[model samples]
Target: MLSVQPVSEAGFAAMAEEWRMCLEASDANPLFMSWPWLYSWWETWSQVLGMELVLLGVFDQRGELVGIGPFCRRVLVTPGGVRVARLYMIGNAWRLAPTVRTEYCAIIARRGSEQAVTAALVPALEQLKWDEMISTDVPVDQLESLKVGRFYDQRGYRMIHRTEDVGIRINTTGRFDDWLAGLGKNTRLKAYNRRSYLKKQGELDFLDHEEGRDGDFFGRLNAFHMNRWGKPAFDREALRFHRLLLQRLHLCEGEPAMSLILYNEHCVSVLYDVVVRGCRYNLQAGYEEDFDPKVSLGYLHLGHAIEAAFSDGATSAYDLLAGNGKNQFYKSHFHGEAVHFSTFQVVRSPLLKALYRIQAASPLFMARGLSRRVGL
Candidate 1:
């Protein structure tokens, strides 16, 4: 028999070793979903943010842990009353290649018992008395390749939301020359001229920093980032969180990782990133107002960053994250694929609907409007 148990403090403590083992056994990369920050975020959200944490344990007949499902509980209030709902927190997770992480592999069961385990776990989760349940960071074939959405459909949950597809770009197995050869003549010429102009001016250089060893770099990085991004659409807390992320990289005391500040004598433009497992992440970039808009300094910065990644022997170069119309159109210029993702919602009652509305409408709790309202 398989049983589902709520994740308790003692439970996570006991299962910590098992979790690590399963992750390695399953061949999951640490950067994707096994970062220490995942645990940190879970703890912070559950403790500081008051979100309820539930870790469903799927055990085999032998009573050992087979699978773990981590979710957060959110309350939805409506005219009728308040109802308990489980939130996937997908958008809020802020991860690259989220679903590709192996930890999300659903129902880790012994060979013959896979279907049986899922069959039992479905009703088990559905019966938890919550008005609705959401599973984010889910695999494409969530229910043993049966697609859990179908299972949810059999029970009564309907899919309500979806987002545009996202994508990741790679350029490792070949040389930069090869990549250039692969592009159209016009694109190749444009990229070559752009890079050549920047290099010839001798203003283009990359400032390097390590996690703990580069305190000065971080200081300048903070000032550069703040002076560039501070007054934009982001809120104070959100911006603080972004800086804390950089600080973690600068302060984590690990391998000799690198954060690059691509700049010229005239202006700073982009931040190129390399993380655990030879992954290169590109930031949106900031440039001095005078030198930024006319020359497309940010795009040039990316061209330089990609060149640097190739020189540094990185396996892949990701374009930071996703973008909207103009931004998305710009990304298409790189000739990469975009991934489409959707959100599934099962509104148990009016209360749940109302809660979702508030979350959807006022991400950051309407801090954007609040800031403008107070003229801050």
Candidate 2:
């Protein structure tokens, strides 16, 4: 028989090795699902938000760990302005906020045991008293394997699915020349011209920094990021969360990488990335605002980083992760495939279900206004 147990923060800390092993065995694992990233995120934000850790650990009859669900309990205001308790995958509550985001969330179940694990998890989840459950950025097949739709239908819970933003992934396995050739002629020429212009302006230097070696880089990076957006990108809590993530990566030997573009010894642009299992996830980036606007330092730095990744043979794909639909412009330049993401909501309350239906039927702008008001 399979058994499920809720693991608190302390319990989770003690089961680091077990969790990591389960992650390794799971087919749906991604950097966001890594023990280091989720643990650090829990440490940084859970208490601040007054949320309770509700991580679930599943074990088989032989007492072997089979799956893990990194979940948390929080209060969410529904579209009708009713506040209710809800459960969500860790880091998912920040989905609408302009903060550090995690994508590709799913139950970390051993490759062939996903169905069984989901069957067990569905019952375990039902035992908890929550108004709704929201999970975002889940892969389509993974969710289907979970059979959440069928499970919810049987239990009379309303399951709603919405198409989220698409995730952009750049395949870097091909030869560098071939990769460049794949980009349209206009984009290729623009990249070349940008690099040439930057090179002529000053001595161009590209530097890579590991986790522990990034000294004052985060501060400068955040400043540049805020300046570019004309507003702050990360709050104090988010900064702390990012710092803890760096430390966690270092401890786990995750080999987090930060690429810097320097012009005459002055940092002009930077790209923070995590490379694991030949997949490079672009976490964050920023560039000096005072640089020559015509040179396009940001684009030049990204091109340099992609080239470096190909040269080092350290990456198979560069994932831009989920973001606003506007990123299609720059991401399209890379000629990458767009992986669509969706959010699934399971509602147990009739009132909430009615509210969701009404919101869904409303005009786009009205629904958006209500969403903002509800803090979605």
Candidate 3:
């Protein structure tokens, strides 16, 4: 038999080791799902957003921790002025949606215990006062499984599953040169021309910073990203969250995983990455827009990062994480496999179900509304 219990922030902190053990025991765990990342996110963003942490723990009869559902509770006021109590992943907040923007989220469980853990999670979640439970970036099959769907049906909850975004990933097992050779002739020509043009400017250097070594990189990354986006990549609190994340990763002896391109001692581009298990997640990046219009420094930096990944034996996949409308062109150039992510929204209230139905019927309008609500 298994039992579910709600864990407070303090309790969650105390169970760090057990949480890590559960994460390691699970298969297909990503860097975003790691203990250090979520915990640091909670510590940094929860208070600022006034979110109530609802971390759930599942234990076996022997009192051994079996699974963890890192979640939080917040209130969402829809465009129709409906106030709905919602439960979301820890890194998510109502105002920011995905406050920390971690991908591949799910209940962390032992390799063979996913079904049981997910089954138990449904009833536990139903008992909460939240009108809706929103889980984003979960595996497709996991959301489609009978265990989850059936459990939601038994609890009188309407389950709405939709593909949120397509993630881009590249298998880095092959040689970097071979991978480059597979690109279109135009791509190859552009890459060569860009590199040749940049080489004439000055000495070029590629640097990798590990944990405990990323001093001003984060600030520089933020500035560069702001320059590109015309706004901060993450707000002040989110920035602090990333700093704490680096510290926590350092303490755990995990890889900080950042890459930068320096031209004549000046940083031209930076790639913020995270390496976990065997996969490397390209979380964020930015480049100097004014460097040289003719030379695509951003493309050059990405090429170098891919080469570095191959050289370092990070032989697993290189994930571009979630794709957005603005980045599709750049992501398309990589020729990576597109893996789709799904979100499961379980709503117990009939009114909320109707709202979801209406939202689904007109996704474009809802997207624009959401953009306005969140100031996106």
Candidate 4:
């Protein structure tokens, strides 16, 4: 049996090395669970949200730290004005000014000790006071082991398991050239042709985020994304959060993956990625639409970025992340393998469980009412 201890926010900051070790020993999303990403997120948003923070530290019989649950509680008010005390994985706070998508969120544990950690987790979490707990955007394999959907079933918590085939990714073999060569002949040709077409216009350069161009790259990334979408990508606070995250990752792990494609000394595209455990998660990308109507800037930029990922030893996969709830399925064109994210919701009390069900369907209720009031 493992023992679980509740860690305060200040003490949790000091567990970077321990957290990294457990992450490597386990199969969690290293990028999302990394100290740099979550800490920076807490540093940025917790101040605004004033979340009740607690980090659960799982220890083996030997008293070694084998797991960490970065958890928090926040009270959310519904349209009906009921205040619900909600439990959340620290990184999944949504619709905030600095709302960064945290994919593959999970409980971090040592590989061999997953069951022990989960066993210890139930009692620890039950001691806390929360009506319901939610942790989403997690991959299925991890969820299978964590069993978060049913983690607290013994405590009379109702369990609901939800899933979505939302992730897209391309796996890489051992070598960069081999991976490029394995692509369909048409894809390979187009990837090359896009770059060649741009080269014809002027000097083409592929620059990685580094000391000389860190600020420049981020500025262009925000500008290009905002211009393309007609709204700011990160807003002011999110920009600051990302800037700090990328810089900190660069310093600690040397993973400055925000890449740029330049055409004739002009910025044409930027791809934001976070590389961890040999997989590169392509978070966001923005390109100059005016470069050429005929040229697929994203396709062109991705080829360069994937090559860098391969060269940098990030050969696990190039994850395009997910396209959930979006009308456009441009990522499908990449023809990468599908990825699924699972969500677990556990409501401890019957009364709160009723609220959970209602909130889950609130959107449909809202739309129907709106349509009736406005006569569609």
Candidate 5:
């Protein structure tokens, strides 16, 4: 028999050893599901955002734990003075969805008893009384075979989907030279010539966070990000949260995974990336926009970075997180492959659902559309 239950702090304490062991086994394993930080992030955000948080786990007949899902609850005030509590979380949390990383990532038994674990969870989810659930940025490929429909449908919850290209990567037959040769001759010459031009400006450098020396790294990173975009790309709150995460975090701990920033003597740029399971998760990247675009510092940084990743044994590099038209232009140049991720909107309250529909369709929609003209 399989059973599901909420994970309490005390209960989590008891499971610490097993939890840590399982998490360390995979880079994509959701670290946000664990104690301390998971709870910290949840509690901190829940208080400010007013979301109820639940850490749920699944266990087998032998009672060996197999899955974890972090469900965040939100209460939406309706038109009729009715207030409904909704439970939702970023998909890819709990290390369940085996693709990109996000909060409350779904976890599943990848090997033993995979089918059994999934079967138990599907029915459990359908029976859940939550008002609304928005599982955002989920790996569609992982859920396709698992049949997510067993738990959700358009009748009860509207399923929405979109895609974006994550970033760039070069296949390595050898070192940087071999990889550059793979690109078209003109592209290769352009990249090489740009590097030659940049060298004349000043020395170029890439810095990674070092123990007790991260302050300088983050400073340079911030400068790079600000330089790339005159205004902040991410919200102030999100950036603050990332700073905290970086302070107490390790990206897969022992791997070559580390936050990096590239700079010339005069300016800087930051590369937002994560290495998980021999794959480089190329998140958002920024460079000094004031620098000459013709010199192509961003492209040069990326070329060297890709070579570095391959040298370190990363098999693949994922571009914008998902593929979109705008994101595809640059991604295509580097031979990016498409991976489908999913988004879901489950609004149990008719009024709130209506509001969401409007919100999704309004002119604000076009204005706030994920796609922007520059910077993928």
Candidate 6:
């Protein structure tokens, strides 16, 4: 039989090696599920929100650590204005700014132990006090693959609260040239011809974190993001968390990467990506605000990044973690597989569950007014 125990911050910290081992042995070894990623969020962003941690450690009969359910408690509002005390996966809280939206969310469990972990979690979770349990940005297949969300439903406790069917998944098989050759004529031009053209515009350079240039890289990335989107991608504390994460990944997962494309003295484009478990996830990016749209400076930079992912023997896929982000309509034109992520919540409170069902049927604005007066 598996046993559940609450872990303190220090206890979780001490489990770093065990966490890494479990992650590597798991079916879904996404960066978001990595210890450094979530722990950094817990140490910085979650702490900033004053959320209370609810880390659960699942142990086998021999007292072997098999899984970790890193959760936190916070009061969150539903689309229908139903305010409930939500027990959210550590990295999958309400998307407050200066925070990241974690995907491939799951209980960090060992490979064959997924079913056991999910089953063990039920009784363990039921013993805790919370109105609902939320695990967001979970890939659809994970229900069967990891025996997660759908497992809860089978146990009589889950709802598909929201679905985000947007992200792009690039199949980076074979060599770079082979992959590039498969692109259509226009895409071929944008990735090659346009990039070559940009290089001729005087002193065009590409710099990355490997050169020990991460200091300036992040600054330029933030500036380009602010100029292009009129807001920053990451604020001070969040940036610190990422910097710590970079260090942690360096020592834990495979080499993480960051890229900055410079045109003369101006930084035209930048991207921050985490490479782990044979996949490169483009977490954030930015580009020149006034650069010629025809040149597609961001696209060119992304081409370079994609090429890097292909070049690396350790990485197999370059996932554009959704959104048409590279300056308005960039992601739409990419040739890659589409991966969908959905947020699943288990509402334990009958009152809150009814309100959410009603809100699901109501108009967008009506959600803001529904259950505003409801307590608990």
Q: Rate the local accuracy (lDDT) of all candidates.
A: 0.48, 0.76, 0.73, 0.74, 0.52, 0.74
Query: Which prediction has more favorable TM-score, 4 or 6?
Result: 6
Q: Taking the tens digit of each residue's C-alpha lDDT, what string does model 5 give over 37-135?
A: 454454335555665556667776777666655565666654445566666662223212122245324454535555666677766666777765556
Give the winner by lDDT: 2 or 6.
Answer: 2
Task: Compose the digit string of candidate 3's lDDT tens values, residues 185-229.
Answer: 666555544677667878877888543654677777779878888
Candidate 1 is scored at a TM of 0.68
After superposing candidate 6 on the true structure, give the runs of residues whose Cα lies further than 4 Å from its correct spot. 75-83, 95-98, 144-160, 210-215, 326-329, 361-365, 371-376
Q: Is candidate 2 or candidate 4 better by lDDT?
A: 2
Better of 1 and 2 by lDDT: 2
In TM-score terms, which candidate is top? Answer: 2
Number of the top-ranking candidate, with lDDT as the measure: 2
- Stretches off by above 4 angstroms in model 3 are 76-81, 94-98, 145-149, 154-156, 189-193, 209-215, 250-253, 325-327, 357-376
Query: How do the residues 1-376 of candidate 1 rate in per-residue lDDT, one tens digit apiece?
Result: 7777776766664565565544444333333343233444454344434456555667767777665455556554433344345554312332211211122323344445556556766666566666655544334444232244467655455444433244446554458777767766655555454666656755565555554644543344455557656744223433443444444442222122344435454335435354544656553355453553325654555655566666766455544444443334565555544533333445554544554565556758584554344321
Candidate 4: tens digits of C-alpha lDDT, residues 1-376? 6888898887777877777777778877778888889888888788788688978999878878899888988876655555668788888764323477777888888887887787778778878888778777878777755555466556576776655657888776457677667677667765655677666768888887664754666677768867777876677668777877876774335375777777767677888887766788887888886777767787778878777666665466888887642346766655578888877777776776665565456698885664344321
All-Cα superposition RMSD per candidate: 7.3, 2.8, 3.5, 3.8, 6.6, 3.1
Residues 248-337, candidate 2: write the lDDT tens digits: 774444767788877888777888888876788887788877787577666676777777767767578877776652244576677788
**For each candidate, what TM-score against the reference?**
0.68, 0.90, 0.87, 0.87, 0.72, 0.88
Candidate 6 per-residue lDDT over residues 140-175, each given as its tens digit: 767553334455665455464655657888877668
Error of 1 at 317 (Å): 5.7
Better lDDT candidate (4, 5): 4
